[model samples]
Target: MDARQKQLCIGEGFHNIDYRILKSIVDCIYEAVCVIDENGIVIVWNKGAEKLYNIAYKDIIGENIEDIFPDAIVNNVRKTGVSVENKYHSPRENSYILANSMPLYIEKVFKGAVSTDRDFAELIKLYFELENANSKLIFLENEVKKISGVFGNIIGKSPNIVKKIDMARQIAPTHASVMITGESGTGKEVFARGIHELSGRKGLFVPVNCSAIPSELFESEFFGYCAGAFTGANKKGKMGIFELADEGTIFLDEIGDMPLHMQAKLLRVLQEREIVRLGGEKNIKLDLRVLAATNKCLQEMVRESKFREDLYYRLNVVEINLPSLRERKEDIPIFIDYFIKEFSTRNSKKIIGTQRDVLNILNEYKWPGNIRELMNVIEHIIVTNKNGMIQKNSIPEYILSQAKKSESFKEYPLDLTKAIKKLETENIKKALKISKNNKSKAAKLLNIPRGTLYHKIDEYKIKCPK
Candidate 1:
C-alpha cells in the first residue's frame, strides 16, 4: 500500500475507536455531561445534558456555550483554568442543579473544560415532603394528648408531679395569677398549657416569650398599636400578646427576663385588667388570665432590686414548683417509655424497648438539661437504632462517658464520716507510694504528723508496697 492510503486507513480506525468510546462512556452517564473546547465552543453534549437543557446535541454542539448558556460553569473553567466542585447553579427558572466543572489539561496546557451536573429539584421536593410528613405527625401527637386529658402532656406519676397536678387542677378554674417556677426544660410550659386548657376560657392561649421581645418593642408587643404608630409598623396595626389573649390566658415564659420598666407596665396591666393601645387613648378592658414562668429566683431579684416586689407579690398568688428530673428519678423509666414510643412512631421504627443495661445507664445519668435532654437522647437512639431494640452501643458516646463517671463516683461513700475516712485512706496510700514506703516522708508529704499517719494506716489497714 502507498503512504497516503496507509495514513488514511490509520486515521479512519482511530476516529472510529474514539467515537465508540465517547458514545459508550460520556454519552451514557445519567448526570448531565458537557465538554467545551479552548474557545468555549461546545464539543461534547451528552444525552443527559440534552434532556436537562432541552436542547439537542445537533443544535448545540458547534455553538459557543456563552450564547446558548451564558452562565455555564464550563465557560468559567475554560477562561480561568480553575475547577469548581459541587457548586449551586440555576441555569433556568425553577431548575436547580449541583455542578462540578474542571479545566481539562493535556501535556501541561489547557485544552478545554468538562462539567457534570445533577438536578437537585427532586432532592428538594423530597425534603419538603419529609418536613410536611413530620408536621402532620406532630399535629397528630398533640391531638392524641388532648384527647387523653387536660394534663395528658405532662408525663409523670411521681409523688411530686402528682401533687403538682392536683394543685394545678384546683387552681385552674380560678382567675388568679399563677407563678410556675422550675429549672429550665422541666415542663413549665407544659404545665402552663394544662392550666389554660382546664380553665375553660373562650379565647386563644397567647404565649409571650418575655426574653425574645426587644426592649424597644415591648410596649407595642404586649399591647395593641394604632395604624401609622411608627415607621415600619404594620399599616393595619397589630394586637399585642395580652390583647390577643383576651378572655383567655397569657403565658409569660422567662418572666424574669422582662426589663424593669416593662415589669412595671405588666404589673399595671395585670392589676387594672385594662390596656391602652400605643398611639391610642381608649383603655381596652381585658379579662385574660396571666400565668408566668421563670427559671430564676424572683425573691433574690427583689432583694437585689432587680425585680419589682409588688409584681412578685401579685404574680405569686400561687407558686407551683415543678420537680427536676434528679428530684424525681423514679419517673425516669416512665419518661423513657413515653419518649421511645413517640420517637419510634415518628421515625417509623419498631423499637420495642431498650435493653435493661441501656435503661440502667440512662437512669443513673444526672440529666442536667432535664426532660428536654432526655427527649433528645431518645430521639437520637431511635434514629440510629437498627434492630427492634435499642442496644448499649446505640446510646450517644457522651451519655456513656457521663454514666461511667457517675458509676465511679458511686463507689465512694456518701456519709460525711465514711467519705472523709475513705478520702484519708486513699491519700495515705498515695503518699506512701510517692515516698517509697518511708513512713516519715509519707507523713511529711501528707502534711500530717507521723503518729497520726501511723494511726490512720492501722485504722484503715492500708497495705504498703514492699
Candidate 2:
C-alpha cells in the first residue's frame, strides 16, 4: 500500500490487522463517523454518516470535506490539532447533532481528525412530547385541586376528617350513589353539596327533606302531576324534584324519614331511570345521580323493616361517615378561628381572637352538637362581644358552667417526675387516637421516632387500638 493508504493504519506492527479492525469497528458504530486527512480531504465515511447527512460515502470519498460540510468539527480539529468533546452543533435547518472530534496523530505528525456525531432530532422531538404531556398532567392536577377546594368548607384536618374527605373525592367522579351518615348538625348537607360540585353533572342540585314532605303529596311533589291531573294543578304542569334534578344530583336529606310506601316508588325510579308524571302516559327518562344523607342508623332500621332493605342497599353504594366534633377535638381551635372570622366578616366586627383562658375552657368542653353548636357559639360571641378579643364573660353561661364542672373533676400531681410521666402517657395516647392507631402516623404526630414511640408505648403499657 502507498503512503496515503498507510496513514489509515494505527502503527507499523499491526498495520493490516489494525486497519481492517478499525474499519470494522467504525462500520459497527451506530453514530455518524467521519475522518479527514491533514488537507481536510474525506477519507472515511460510515453508513451512519450517509444516512444522517444524506450523502453517500462513495460520492464524498477523496473530496474536500470543507466543500460539503463547511461547519464540520472535523475540519476545525484538523486545522487546530485540538479535540472537541461532546459539543452541540447544527449543520442545517431541522438537523441537530452532538459531536466529539479528536485529532489523529502518528509519529508526532497530525494525520487528520476523526469525529462521531449523534443525531439529536429524535431526542428533541421526544423532549417536546414529554413537555406537552407534563403540561396536560399539571392542568388535570390543578382541576382536581379546584374540585377538592369545595371540601374546604367542611374544615378540620384530623385523620378521620381527612380520610372522609379523601373518600369523597375518590367517589365524586363516578356515577355511584353515596350515603353520608353522621350526627345531626354534622354538616352532612355540606358534604353532599361538595360531592355534587365535583361530580361534573351540569344539572341543578335538588335537595329533598323526606320528613317535611307530606305522605299524601309525595307522588305529586316527587313526580309532578300533569295538566288537569289534580283539581288545583297548574295547566302547564310542573316538574317534580326528580325531574328538576335531571342530568344533575338529587340530595335526599333525611332519607331515613322517607315512608315505606314512598321508598318503593323511589326504588322504581332509580332502577328504571325513568319517571311517569301523574296522569301522563309518557315515561320521561332521567340521567341523574343520587346522593343521600341521614343522621339515623339505617342499618338498624332496615332490620326492623322501617327502611326498605333493597332501597337501602341501592343508595348505600359508598358510605362516608363524618366524625362528630367530640371525636376530633384537636381541630376545635382551628374551628374556632374559622367561625370567628366568618361571623366577624358577616356581622361587620373586627374580633381579633379569643382569650387564651377562654380557648382552654372551650377546648375542655365536649361539643355534643358538633360543628353546628360550635358555629352557634362563635356567632353568639361575635354578636354579643363589645371588644376586639373574645372574653370569658362573652361566652354563653351554659358552656362556662359545663367547663367549670369539667375542671372540678380533674386532679393535680405535685411530684415532678410523676407529672412528667403522666403528661407523656396522655400525649402518647392522644397521638395514637389522632392517628387511628397507625404507629408510623402516631409517631409523626408525636414528633418522635417510631422506635422511640414503640419504647414509650411499652414503658407506659399503653394499649393501642386495632
Best by TM-score: 1
TM-score of 2: 0.56
Cα lDDT tens digits, model 2, 225-325, are 89999898999998899999999999999999998999999999999999999989999999999999999999999999999999999999999998998
lDDT by residue (303-415, candidate 1, tens digit) is: 99999999999999999999999999999999998888777767766665668999999998889999999999999999998877789998899999998888878878889
For all predicted structures, in order, the TM-scores are 0.61, 0.56
Candidate 2: stretches off by over 4 Å: 1-149, 411-466
Pairs of residues clashing in candidate 2: none
lDDT of 2: 0.85
Error of 2 at 215 (Å): 1.9
Alpha-carbon RMSD, each predicted model = 14.7, 20.1
